[model samples]
Target: MLNRTAKFLTICLLAQPLPPAALTVTAAASENAALRDISKIQVDERRLTEAVASRTLTWLTGSPANNDYISVGRLANFFGFVGLRVTSGHSLKRSEVARETLSVLTEQQRTQMVSLVHAQKDTLNRAHEARQEMNRALEGLLAFEHVTREQFIELGRDYGAREAELGRLLAQTFGDIAQTLSTDQQRALTDIRTTHLSGERRQGNGGGDPKLRQSKADKKELVNLTARFLSWTTGSQEFNDFEVVGKPSQHFGFVALRIGSNHGVKRGLVAKEVLEILTPSQIDRLREAALQNAREFPMFLEVRAQLMRVLETSLSGGVIDPAHTAHLGAEIGEIEASMTWSQAAAMLDVRDGLSEAQSADLLAMRAKYTAETDSSDLDDPIERGRQLFAQCAFCHNSDSRQPIGPPLDDIVGKPIASDPAFKRYSPALVRYARAQSMWTEAQLDAFLKSPKALVPGTFMSFDGYEETDDRSALIAYLKTRK
Candidate 1:
């Protein structure tokens, strides 16, 4: 907990009035202070969050009347968006904005989209159910100290298959909606997906973000500053269950954060990276925009967090009270009333401020950093093995340090329970080791290929690589031993 003195200082720093300095960030300290303040406010206002959340249950029923655009077919996704609403600031409020194209559409066209969304309730429900099952499996991992090898392997496979089925159903639902839109509206939709929704300012970008990292020290400070805002993201199991199941994104990707629900992209770190190519004047503009964004983020994030709790709870535990849902709507209205819609326009200023060539470079840089493998290196088994090891990097360190799992250092020759550095070995693994002592290549292969069948209660959360070559490659890399 922060001292009262410290917390008040932080709020003062953030709320300090800035001089009217168009694009220039006149006070860097004030900007930093605002960000810290906003993050703190988001984290500390627990009751406010719950109160607002109790009102958003209406979201489960249908889109409410608002200045915001609505489509019956897109309602589920809209609900998801509302759940994700706090990432940006400004006119993106649940109120305040509407799509010009959507506004002009005929009632019948709107009804068609809603009808299509209604039609897929069964498919969506199935996907939701499968996801719940996976969440239960993952919850087991969270509850126990060590995952049995069998649990680890089976959970991996089950999670992957479930995701695939859900993805297909969602794709079909979205496709049906897309088909209903006119060409112009379709273009508008694409623009929303690729442009307005995309925070990228540069042009000619193929796709994906560069996996640039900022200094660890700076990032640690950013994390501390935003710890409150990050509490639910990093600590909430419900939030964790809903995050994307794929590999962590390489760079700041298409979305701001790909580091799982653990944290938002270190915005200060990303800002440092993105600002590198911009001119000094452009840097000032972006800085100003960031500071302005800081002002509204605290309120926005708090409301969104509460709403997420409501949604995730409903998804897992069934519907919440209607009164809470109504309160949430009221909260949204309150926040919208006070918010100054500057960030989006400021974002545009930053976008237009950048030269076209810089945009191209930014795009190219991200694409280069996108998690693409070098085709030329495919012939080398060792190279392929290293490539296959990336997924494991999420939880296991090659060094002696344990991440989520034991380190891989000299793992090939290690006695099952003999690694002195690892203090919390699973009992199942220890008992298995009594019969077979060492981690031989065959044991490794089977474990890597299918962990659940091999050791049912092990704590490893990875799904085994089904491809023979991929598993071989990963094993090959492991043999090298850091």
Candidate 2:
């Protein structure tokens, strides 16, 4: 009779009705409270753990992983669960079992769960902020000799104890809510917690306590300097240039000084520094505008200054002198003249005053620069060609994997048809690949000299190289692969 009664009770438990609406509302409220408490606990515990871990690892092993990766709140939550499991003696293999036990909620109940989860996440974010504040305080305290390791550890221990108590209370509250819920409601709550809460916990692990990287005064000064430099460089109203033929005549001397002062440019390094600082976007825009207008546009002084600084920092020697600056300005003018209108428009994303042909030219230029090449001989030109190749290098380099033309890395050995990553190949070139076996050095040399004639439908717009010596030198240089 007792066995039958036990069996009846089990059936009744399984057949229990869906929870009352009130129960779900209460559970959601309780879950939110629990999560908030858990967040605080986790954050506090994380701080303690990080301090201990950093000290132990540094002392014993002479190295430690970056403490910046640690999140006290997350660690607290994980350990809190471990503590709960320990106390309850629940030997569930996975949190999924708990979810399944709570899975019978309605759509409304699920939404409530989501709302609760969001609330929990917000609390965790606040907790993170608090942790950061504490860390900053601790960092400041470290400057003093009176605050010893023992004191730090003691403080951490206190934080940990408080966290553990919070966790215990949350677990107790959750258990109480679970008891009141119907079997279905319990399952829904479990599912929500497992999916939503679990994700929050995982994300909480890496957001380290914020450190005070700079003083307010320093930050303010930096901001001011940046604004001034940007205004001068970007052609903002502050350093307005005098207009010549509806275009601004750049203040070259002022630009040079700005570059020198900001970047510390000397003689030999000035030209190179200036070139390096000009972004592909800036150059392309300038070049296109020059081509379209058939005139030189003054460079923004602010832009020049920024470029100079970048150059000075990147190179060994200081900034450029007057003569070199003039030379650089001339070179820039020549390059700008060679730019097609289309290229300029593309850079600025401006359609004003640009012809279709100019737009087409810009697109073509961009395509040429972005396109991949299989020619191994492209980089190595003969000794005489080396000087000439410098012109080409203005738009190309190994560092950026982008030049005004395709990257020449591993071009020599690469099969013509195999590399799909090279998107710049003309349709004619693609067809040629199908017809030919591979691109050899000799074949590349011939093609470079007369691209359109070699591959009639090829999109290469450059006039073929007229000098055989130039072609041969270019080929020879290309042979010496890096």
Candidate 3:
């Protein structure tokens, strides 16, 4: 209902105008009436379209962060306990720990630890390989306008299997690593991890932070913050998938505290993400804002409820009443203006506050995180088909509903315009459907290439696809709808 296109940078936040005084109720009363109406309204949640989910998820991917936020002391403890060498009072590369064994452990223990490490290594490598494979699979899916259920499910299964195998090996490795350490060393490790890994998993955390231990109150507040963000973004917390929280965010231009894109893990705890970033001062500011924001967030929600109320009460039966339209539009118009101004102000503040170096860093990070435009997903036939399909969507519903134009659903195998339910089809298509047995692939291709040529008197106004590849792709997409 809001005008997303208009810039409201110069908006004046004057008191919102009342619904034309002729309305029997005051502004406060109208809004209260709307709130009550909406409170009782029940509607099914809307899940994102598959194409949107895939595309957003793809954007969330690309280059993963590959570094440490952990402290040196914790790192030394972890390495030493894991049977890795950590010479005292000497700075060494983090990778150096992987190459050498601690002299404190017996040779037999070393041998056992090495074997366990080798097994862990193999499992980790396999998971990495599967992730690479899954990346390719996702690339293909994102490029397609339409995909069969089997395609997404099959790829998800492949990735799920690898994640499960990796998780099992990782758990085993933790126990095995502890076994190699002396009791005192194991205690040292536990003490070091007390803050860093408290309530957090130790495996593959993108080299997590040691400074991220949170109090119960802090953890509860973070949970509430996460719930609010999810609500704002997804329109509902339930509007989510069982994919890795971070992975989908890679696509959706947001961040999630999720671990990986393995099955069933919806998100990473907000505390872990904070630990990963380890910017406590900024986090404190954000947390304070979040607490305040969450309490006030309901106002924006009520705006939506208020709009729906206006639409319902203002309309005459199923049609808009010209008399009420002006009043209805004004209420929505003010809300949109305020929101636009606030959003623009936030961006402006960021832009104004950034130093040249910080700006450059942000630019560079954005570049690194963004997917390569020339990636294979760009060249996939399904992607090309999807781009072409957007033009057609203006007139056709894939699900064959809404009667805006003839639906393409089942148009591949069914005789053209033969649906007894669809009377809006042009007479030309009607006659053709009566004469033709079924719409073959060749027929679809030819029709897409030149609709007017195929049926001279057709009511359809599409300027057909001029390129052979475009028509072929269109026909290919249509064929799969059945």
Write the number of the candidate with greater TM-score, choosing between 1 and 2: 1
> Using Cα atoms with residue i matched to residue i, what is each candidate's TM-score against the true structure?
0.28, 0.24, 0.28
Model 2: lDDT of residue 102:
22
Q: How well is each residue in 1-482 modelled by candidate 1, as lDDT tens digits?
A: 00111121111122221111101112332243212222232322222222122111111111111101112222122122321223222112221112222342345644443444445456555534543333333222222223343443343333333333332333333333333445554333334322322333324222222222436533332222122111211122222222110111101122212122133333334344555666777555544544443444454434434544443332222444445543543453233222222322233344444443554444444333322222222566665565445335334532313334566767887788786766677787888889889999889889898887787787654557676777677678778855
Weakest 10 consecutive residues of candidate 2 by summed lDDT? 1-10
Rank candidates, TM-score, best first: 3, 1, 2
Q: What TM-score does structure 3 among the candidates reach?
A: 0.28
CA RMSD of each candidate after superposition: 24.4, 31.5, 24.3
Candidate 1 positional error at 466, Å: 0.5
- Number of clashes in model 2? 36
Residue 254 in candidate 3, Cα distance off native in Å: 7.4
What are the per-residue Cα lDDT tens digits for candidate 3 across 1-482?
Answer: 23333221111111232222101112332243212222222211111122122222223222221111111121101112111111111122232222112232345644544454445456555545544443343333333334443444344344334433443333233334333455554333323222121222234322232132446544332222222211111111111110111121122223221223222222223223322332344334334423332332233333323333333221112332333433432433233233222222222223233333433343333343322222122355654564455435434542323334666766777777777666677788878877676788888887888889998888766647677776776677656665
lDDT (CA) for every model shown? 0.37, 0.33, 0.35
Best-fitting candidate, measured by lDDT? 1
